[model samples]
Target: MLVDGHHLLYRAHFGFPRRVTGSSGEDLTGLFGFVALLRKAHREHCPGQEVFVVFDAEDGAADRAENVPGYKAGRAGADHSPVVHLPAVKQALDAAGVRWLEQPGCEGDDVLATLAKLAVVTGREVLVFSGDRDLYGLLDGQRVRALNTQLPAGRQLVTAADVADRFGVHPVQWPDFRALTGDASDGIPGVAGVGPVTARQLLAGGRRLEDLPETASGRAGTGLARARAQWQEVLAWREALRLNAHVPVPDDLLTGRPTPGLVPAGQLLTEAGLW
Candidate 1:
């Protein structure tokens, strides 16, 4: 199982309203929730699976930001609650003896995607745990599946069929899908007036945006026509949105070394002086 480290950490920080505090009144809610989440995933979904967590490097998205103005710019000004607790989260991971990695220029999504591909190539099944829909693009029916522990049905896996059923696009086409419709979370401004329904229509029949005529009639066609001038930009967005499944991960990392046994959540907090 591959986990999106920061995604789950951020979710845990915001999901819990009660502020768990330490001796100096420092917030421990994020730490507590993060540990609990990992424990839950371990007890329920990870008993037999080799678990690895991937975090986005501090400057992971710098390239994308430079290429596309306003790329995740909003987050730059947002509250720091989500990342402030990361140090503690890492501490807990160390306590649990879990495996994780953060490369200088790679986002967690790309790292997870790369690891997933490597795992699949070796005939191992891959399950990605992340709240970020961007990883949905990494799903492959036979080998890869995505999961969001934040969901009410936390253990329910998202497969390629689910992507097709929900979004009218195959998992492989997810980047293109978002490129046309725009990913609001990342501040991608897709062609104005183009929405999911139209984007879906344009991308139907396994035809990519470049495969279609630049000019045509009707809503989907008109949207495509209007986007031609910005095709290069859109293409860049597609690349930005696409997960780099080839991020150089070492072969040894795939061997799943024996992690130290997990420390109980209560013990972890008590040891950290948060209890």
Candidate 2:
């Protein structure tokens, strides 16, 4: 299983209260929740599966920002206290002997996407442990899926079918879907007057954003006329949402199999002096 480190770390830090702490009185919310999530994932999703965690560097999304100045700018303006717990989480991971990476100039999603693609090329099936909807674009259905342990409705194993079933689009078209809808979370202001239905309609029939403008139906689409007028921005958003499958991880790390960190998380926490 591949993990999105910041995604789960933030989820854990926020979902769990600040009530927990280590022997030294340092906050242990992230450590506790992250370990529990990983432990449960191992028990329920992959008892014998190897686990690899990918973390975002400080400027992981800089490349995207270069293309679009506002990319993820909201995050910079949001509360950053959660990142304080990253070190403790890493400590717990190390204590558990889990393998992880924090590649320079790469986001966790891209690294996970790259690894997932390579794993499939080697005929390996991968389950991604993340709640980031953006990762849905990586779903290959047969070989790739994202497992979320954070959902209150209960954990869900999301495949390409789930994306299609939920959004009327397949995994490959997920970038296009995001393009039309825009992700305010990332500060990608979508086309004006456009939402889900209109976006789906524009992207329907296996047509790309660039081609949609040339279609008679697209030129005459009833809703989101302003968005249609701003098709160039939607296309740009789609390209930004597209995952890069060539993030260049070390070949030595692709061992064709993952070696799970089976040491009980409780033991790891204790070893970290957090229990």
Candidate 3:
């Protein structure tokens, strides 16, 4: 199972209250929340054979910043002073013997994608845990499944069929879908006039951004044409937005067992002073 560590951690950090803390007077809400998530995944999937927690390397934001100055720039100015027990969280994970992977230029999504692909080839059933919708593109071949924590209770299974039902496009076509629609969160400027509706039509029409007709009429056609123009920029930016899975995530980084530790939870709690 591949876990989107950054996505889950960040969500845990923000979703829960800030009142949780460790014995050291450090905030432990995020750590405790993450541990709870880990425990849930362990209990449900029993993927004890091989499990990986992939984190986004800090350096990846620089690449995004270079492409677009506003890429995750808001986080740069956010108030992180209140929740500063992250190092302890890492130590807690280490103490628990959970394997963690990170690559300098790639985000957690890329690492998860690469690992999922490898798992497919190796005859392993892959389950990706993340709240980010972008990872939905990786679902295919019945070998991959994405569990989105953002969905409603008992509706977290985001399958290939779910993608088709929700977005009117195939899972593989998501990247193309986003390319035309652009993602404000990631600072991707999708096709100019194309909204989600038009983007879906273009994708449903079986035309990639570059292959769409230049001038067309009707709501869908006009929006798609504008999207085609915007896609020109998206095509160039897509490379920047895409995750690089080729970067070697050393085996040493993932070296560990999945045994649960008694102190891991309390250590995380104490480190952040949630105890």
Candidate 4:
């Protein structure tokens, strides 16, 4: 299983009800919640699976921002307190003998995509733990699926079928789909007047933006017309959303061995003198 470090950390820090402080009164909720969530998921769903955690470097989104100046700019003012817990989280993971990574100039999603693709090439089924919809592009239904822990019991796994059923598009078309729909979470302001239904209609019959009819009528069609008017921007957005599966990663990332069971979060923290 591959874990998206920032995704889980942010969720744990914000979603956790109460604060957790260390002996020195430092906030430890981010660390505690991240470990707790990871432990619970590993124990319940993947007891014998190897776990790899991937984090984003400080300038992880640099390339994307070059293309779209406003990419993820909305998050500039968001709470960043959870990031302070990264060191503790990494320390705890190391103490438990878990392998984690944060490659320079790379986002966790790309790293996860690269590792997931590598694992699949070796015939190992992979589960990516992330709430970010961008990772939905990696779903293959059989070997690759996102572990949607936020979902209910049986519906936790997000397969390619789920993506198709939910978005009326294939996983491969995720970048295209998201480009048209405008991901507010990432500060992407999609073409004016285009919404989900319209985007789906424009992309019907498995057609990409390039394959859409040049001329059409009606509201959605009119939206498509507008999208076509600013064709270059839409195309750029799609390219930005596309995941790079060929990132260079260490060969020793996977040793075909199951990870030993992780020590409990509290116990590990206590041993590390953080709690």
RMSD of each: 2.0, 2.3, 3.2, 1.1
Query: Global lDDT of each model?
Result: 0.80, 0.79, 0.69, 0.89
lDDT of 1 by residue, 89-197 (tens): 7777766678788888888888898898888888888888887899988889958988776667844778898888888989878888888889988988888888988
lDDT of 4 at 114: 95
**Model 1 ranges with Cα > 4 A deviation:** 213-216, 257-261, 272-275
Q: Show the lowest summed lDDT stretch of 10 residues, model 1.
A: 254-263
- The candidate scoring highest on lDDT is 4
Off by over 4 Å in 3: 47-49, 79-83, 251-264, 267-275
Candidate 3 lDDT, tens digit per residue, 1-275? 67888776777778854556655675667778777777676666654545678887878677667765566665767666424655655666676666677778777787887777766776777778887888887888568988876678788777898888888887767777887777776777676777878778766656665666665668777786565555446775666566555656654443334545334454555554445
Candidate 4 C-alpha lDDT tens digits along 1-275: 99999999999999877888778898889999998899988998889999999999999899999999899998999999899889989998888878999999998889999999999999999999988899999999789999968889999989999988988999988888889889898878888888888888888889988888876779777988889888899988998888998778899987778888878888889997768
Candidate number with the higher TM-score (1 or 3): 1
Candidate 2 per-residue C-alpha lDDT over 1-275 given as tens digits, one digit per residue, 9 for 90 to 100? 99999988788778865456766787777767788878878878887777888999998898898987799998877777778878777877777778889989998888999999888988889999988898998898669989986565453888888777778778888888787778888778887656777777777776666656544355336545666677677767887888998998897666646566456656777877757
* Top TM-score hit: 4
Model 2 clash pairs are none
**Ranked candidates, highest TM-score first:** 4, 1, 2, 3
